[model samples]
Target: MRMRTKAVLLIVFLSCLAGCGSREPSAQSPQAASSSHADSGEIVLEADSLKLGQIRTAPVVVQAAPWDEFETPGRVELDPNRVSHVLMPVPGRIRQVLVRLGDAVQEGQPLLIIESPEVSAAVAAYRQAQAELRRAQSALSKAERDLSRIRDLFANRAAAQRDVWAAENEVAQAQAAVEQAKAEQEQARHRLELLGISPNEPVQQISVPAPTSGKVLEIAVAAGEFRTDTSTSLMTIADLSHVWITANVPENLIRLVQIGENVEVELAAYPGEVLRGTVRRIADTLDAETRTVKVQTELPNPSGRLRPGMFGRIRHSHGLKPVAAVPPAALVQDNEGAFVYLEKGRGRFQRRRVRAGQPRNGWAPITEGLSPGERVVVDGAILLSGK
Candidate 1:
C-alpha cells in the first residue's frame, strides 16, 4: 500500500511538469503569429508613425510625357578637333623640358628647348648669302660705271667699239650674278623662318612653342633625351574647357539622335547631377563590330570637372508617349525585386510587385503590375519596405 501511494504521487508530479512545458509554447504562439503576419506584405501605420516616417503618397496616373530615354555606356573623351599634337620639329637633343605633363599653356608659349646644330648651320648659310648679295651689288654698280665710261670713249673715238661691247657684257654678267645672289638669300631666309629660328640670331637651342592654349595631356620626351624623329609627337595638349562625350547608339535609334539635339549626361562621379550638352556630330558609318553609330555630344566643362576616359551615360528625350508612371520616391527594392506600396485605405498599405522602366526627370515608368488611378506610397515607401 505504501509503494502504490508513492508511485501515484510521482506520476501526478510528472504530469504536472509535462503540462507546464506544453503551456510555455502555447503562451509564445501569439508572438510568432504576430511576426508572421507582419511579414505578409501588409503594413498598417498610425497617424503618428506616418508623420514620423515622413511617408507621402500620390496617385498613379497615365500621362503623355517624354518617354524615358535609354542609356548607352559611353566614355568622356577629349574633343579630337580641339586636341593639339605637339610634334618634334627637328632632330635634336632635348636641352630642357620647360613644361611637365598636365601643364597649362597659352598660345605661343615656349614649351621646351632643344639643342640642334641645324639652326646654327641654317643661320650661317643665310649670313653668307647676305654677304654674297652685298658683294654682287657692289660689283654690278662698278660694272655699270665702266660700261658707261667705255661707251662715252667709243662715241668720242677714244676707245674701240669691241671694248665698249665687252664692258656692257661685263655689266650684264654682274647683273645676272646679283639676281642669282638675291634669290639665294631669299631662299636661305625662308629656310630659317621655316625652322622657327631668327635669321639674325641663329642659336644652337630651338624653343618649341605651344600652338594653342590647353593642358598638356602627354609627354614623350625628357630633358637630355636625344630625339631623332621629327614625325613623332613630343607632347599632346588638349583644351579641357569643353569635352566630348562619345556614345555608341544602336543603329535603330540613330535616327532619333540628330545633330544639334540636346542631351543630358550623367557621370558616376557626380551623382544626381545632369550635365547638359548638344549633339555636335554623328558618325556617317556604323561600327561593324558593335552595329552601332558613334554619337558625339559636346558639353561645356568650364570647371574642368569632366575628365577624359570617364564612364557616363547619355540621355536624349524621344517624343511624348502615354505611360503609366510614378514618382521615383515610390520605388523600393528587396531581395525579390522592385516594389511599391499600394494604399488600400486610410493607414493601410500593401506591398505590390512592379516592373519599372527607365527613370527620367524624377519619374519612373511602370511596365507591369501597376495600373493608373491607384494610390502608391511615394516618399515613405522606404519606411514600409523596412517593416
Candidate 2:
C-alpha cells in the first residue's frame, strides 16, 4: 500500500510540471523575444554569430555639396580710370609746390610751378610772334593804301599800267606777309600750350596741373626739387568716388562669375560692415601659377571711405536651381571619395556618392546624385554607418 501511494504522487507531480510548461513562456524569455522581434526590421546588430549583407537604400537628400565656389585671397584696387599721376612734362627745377599731400584739386588746377629754359623759350617765342603780327598789320595797311592810289592814277592815265601792276604786286606781298605772321602766331601758341603755359597769359614757368578732380594720394616733389622728363613721379592723384575689388576665383568657378552678377564685399579694416558691388570683368585666361581666373567688381565709395590695398572677402551666389543638398555633417570623406548615407528605416543606412555645389549660409548645393525631399541620416550617420 505505501509503494502504490508514492507512485501515484510522483505521476501527479509530473503531470503538473507538463501542464505549467504548455500554458505560457516565462516572463524573462517573452520580454527577450519581443525585443528581438522589435529589432528585426532595421536591426543593427553586432552579434558574433549573425551575418548580414549590403542592400540598396533609398536616395538621401544632402545639404552639403562639392559645387562650392572656390575662394582666393584678394585685395582692393584703385580704379585705373579714376587715377592720374601729376608729373612734370619737361625737365625743370620745381620752384614751388602749391599743393600738399591729400589736398583736393580741380581739373586743370596748377599744383606746382617749375622754372625751365624750355618754358622761358616758349614765352619768348609767343611775345615775338605778337610783335611781328603788329608790324605785318601796319605794313599791309600802308601797301593797300598805296595800291588804291596807284589804281586811281592809272584809271585817269596819270600812272603807267606797268607802274600800277608793280604797286599791286607789292600789296600782294604785304598781304602774304600778314598771313605768314598769323601762321607763326598760332605755332607759337601751341608751343606755349605744350609747356603748360596759356597762350593769353605771360607765364614765365611751366605749371604742373591736375588732370582730374581728385585728392592727392602722394606727393614726391617738394619746393626746389629738380624734376626731369624721366622723373619717377611728382604726385599721384586718385578720384575715390569709386574703387575696384579684384578677386581671383578658381578656374572651375569662372563660368559662374558673370558681368552684372551681384556680390557682397567685406573689408578687413572695417569689421562687421559689408559693401555692395557688381561684377565688372572676368578674365579670359587662367593664371598658370595659381590656376585661377581674375574677376573684377566695382564698389561705390561715394563717401571716400574705401581705400586701396585693403584686404576684402567676396560673397555671391551661383543662382538657385535644383540640386542635391544634405546637411554638412552628413558628408563623409575617405580614400574612396565623398559619400553620404541614406536612412531607409530606423537604424538603417546605405552609402551613396554625390557631387556638391556652392554653399551659402550653411546650405550647400548638390550638383548631382540626389533628389529633393529624401530622408538622409544627418545626426546619427556615424552611428548608423557601423550597422
Q: Model-by-model lDDT, in order?
A: 0.87, 0.76
Worst 10 residues of 2 by lDDT: 49-58
CA displacement after TM-score superposition, residue 42 of candidate 1 (Å): 14
lDDT of 1 at 373: 93
Number of the predicted model whose TM-score against the real structure is largest: 1
Using all chains and alpha carbons, the TM-scores for the candidates as numbered come to 0.68, 0.67
Query: For residues 1-387, could you state the per-residue lDDT of candidate 2 as single tens digits?
Result: 999999999999999999888766675687986787566545343434223222323344444332334555568998888898876777888898888888889999999888888777777888899899999999999999999999999999999999888988988999999999999999998877767777666655777788999999998878887767645777899998889999989877776678998887889899778788988888888899988888998999988888889997987765444456666666677787666776555444456677655445556566766677776555545554554
Clashing pairs in 1: none
Question: Which portions of model 2 show Cα errors greater than 4 Å?
Answer: 1-74, 98-104, 108-110, 117-120, 187-207, 230-232, 248-294, 312-319, 327-338, 349-351, 377-387
Q: Give the TM-score of candidate 2.
A: 0.67
lDDT of 1 at 128: 97
Q: What tens-digit string does per-residue lDDT give for candidate 1 at 1-387?
A: 999999999999999999999899989999997897777756777766645457778999886666646578778999998999887777899989999888899999998898988889889999999999999999999999999999889999999989998998999999999999999999999988767898767488888999899999999889999988888988999999999999999977887778998998999989889899999999999899989999999999898989999999998877788878999878888788888999887777898999887777778888888899999988856567566
